[model samples]
Target: MSFLTFGVGPSKLSAETAQDLRNAADLQIAEISHRSQAFAEISRRALGGLRTFLRIPDSYHILYTSSASEAMELTIQSTVELASFHFAQGKWSQYFADIAKHFRRRVLIDTVEWGQKNDFRNTFVPTEADLITICHSETSTGVACDLADIRAVRHRFPSTFLAVDGTSIMGAVAVDIALADIWLFSVQKCFGLPAGLGVMIVHERVFERAADLIARGVHNPGVFNLPAMFTMVQKDCNTVATPNVLGIYLLAQQMERWNAQCTMESRERETREKAELLGRAIEKSSSFRFLVRAPEDRSPTVCCVRSDPQTITSLHALCRAQGIELGKGYGKLKEETVRIANFPAITCGDIQRLLQVLEHVRSRTPAA
Candidate 1:
């Protein structure tokens, strides 16, 4: 049997975006120096548009990185001092802890069950720690933490910086950058752009602190070089090696489109509606169920599903035959779950088509 399967991320690019990519390719010329006016202008525009799209505060400065993981590494490596507290439950959250430990930063980890909610008020966070990191949405398990609740916890520790990985939720959801000291993400997820660009909106205070650390020669600034990043912004150029020119261009254009049609408030409402629609469909499907149970805590962009891996694998094969590629569950949850992304670009018709395909797959697959 053949049908389109719903899975997380790298969703089918919109035809308009595809055309924009083709246009970009046509415009590419050899030896367009990164320092030249052409590239700097592009970088400047992309940064401005991204900040506007994300509703990032004017006090927060924007910086570019190669990927979200790189942005995470930079933020963690640079600002994190002493033992930091990490909220761990999902795959990427676990990695956040692991990365911090690799940086030789002491980790105070709080782990909840895969599909369970974490009350930051209950978590034993250290007051002495300088940084606390959490994934805004854990794509692997489809658990999205309440940013407002988490920020309330941060308020208890006035000195600690809050860094959130908005990788899976950014544009599709509403995140108050003011609540968190660092909000970082990549273009591939909600921005509906191809991979290769990562953005970080950092608080002015964090930048000031980083600058002070650099002056003291006490902090080792690895990938998160605040000084260098600030310099590039002044130059109207993106730092951290050569920027992804084409990705930046496409992202800027996409942001422009998003502004023209959908604002954050509208995007958030649309995402909630789509996720509800899809979640209800999955709940009704006897062959499949949600990995994350609650809509309130679920990621609007990535829906992790609970099912037999073989069943999911078969369904994936069936979908591919129909020109639809579903995302596989990552890491420990691979066998039991699959992910479905429902962001802005994915239309209501897309969800309807996916549901139709899933129903067909269910009817054909024998009951286990």
Candidate 2:
């Protein structure tokens, strides 16, 4: 739904709040030159806020790109010399593998069904694999890869690099930033901001790997290579290309707001409460059943619910006509399930209204 894509303004559930656009207007962030000292200050504040909010370690460096997919392309092209193994938890994680394949890297994946976890066991990982990728939150299926499982993979495959995608839950969840050598995400979903900014938090080892690839004369250092991006990042937090200046400013503002008002722990507690509320509501509904049946498999941010195709269609139209919006299911579940984004931008009042609408619709329609 449009609301899932910045349709709901300041009330977002996570690091976003009201008066953001007004504050931007007051500061005139839009008019500043990218290389100017003013933009540099903005960039520093934004990076600083991200470090504070995400607890990024000193061992890692953050890079900016046009989008998260670009981050995948850069990482894949630069570090992967021989092969890359993927935990294809859902469509997005699979997309990471797809990028590596596009670069001609031998790709191997342990594909898992929707609503299930990936096998972090050593049996699935290859010794020759240069990098291992996993999606911490699978937005499509509403399932998550356990951080413990990831850490176990790390211990077993100590030499291979690890990459984790946090696209759908970065701002809303507390991630152990050290769990992977590379962590990437886009701003739209959890950060509750408009799209076009992609962030990659990379471990120093990733740079070493990229450098090794370069020395071997086999590296594909796309226009925005790791070393080059690192150089620009050191240039007072500047980016390689003309950056997403507005997105960075708004993110810094939102990060500062979140830092002042909400601890990540508290934000997670709020997320759990909201999830529980939605879970109960879904359990009680006659026409709507959770697509992911297990409680542990459900995402803290994206909730997927299943119903008949007709009910799903009716619900979409009903929610649409009332100015309420919900996320649509992806892949094979598209027509049979509806997604409820549990982003903080969506308030409890919004949830109640959505539930009321859902209940109202269900009362009149028979379940399959």
Residue 322, model 1: lDDT of 69
Clash list (residue pairs), candidate 2: 11-345, 12-344, 12-345, 13-344, 13-345, 14-344
Clash number for candidate 1: 2
RMSD of each: 2.7, 2.6
* lDDT by residue for model 2 (118-173), tens: 77865567788988888888888888766687788888888888888888877777
Query: In candidate 1, where is summed lDDT lowest over 10 consecutive residues?
Result: 1-10
Stretches of candidate 1 exceeding 4 Å from the true structure: 1-7, 29-31, 222-224, 363-368
Tens-place lDDT digits, model 1, residues 251-303: 76787788788788888999888988888888788888777777688877888
- Every candidate's lDDT: 0.77, 0.81
- If candidate 1 were superposed on the true structure by all CA atoms, what would the RMSD be? 2.7
User: Which candidate tops lDDT?
Assistant: 2
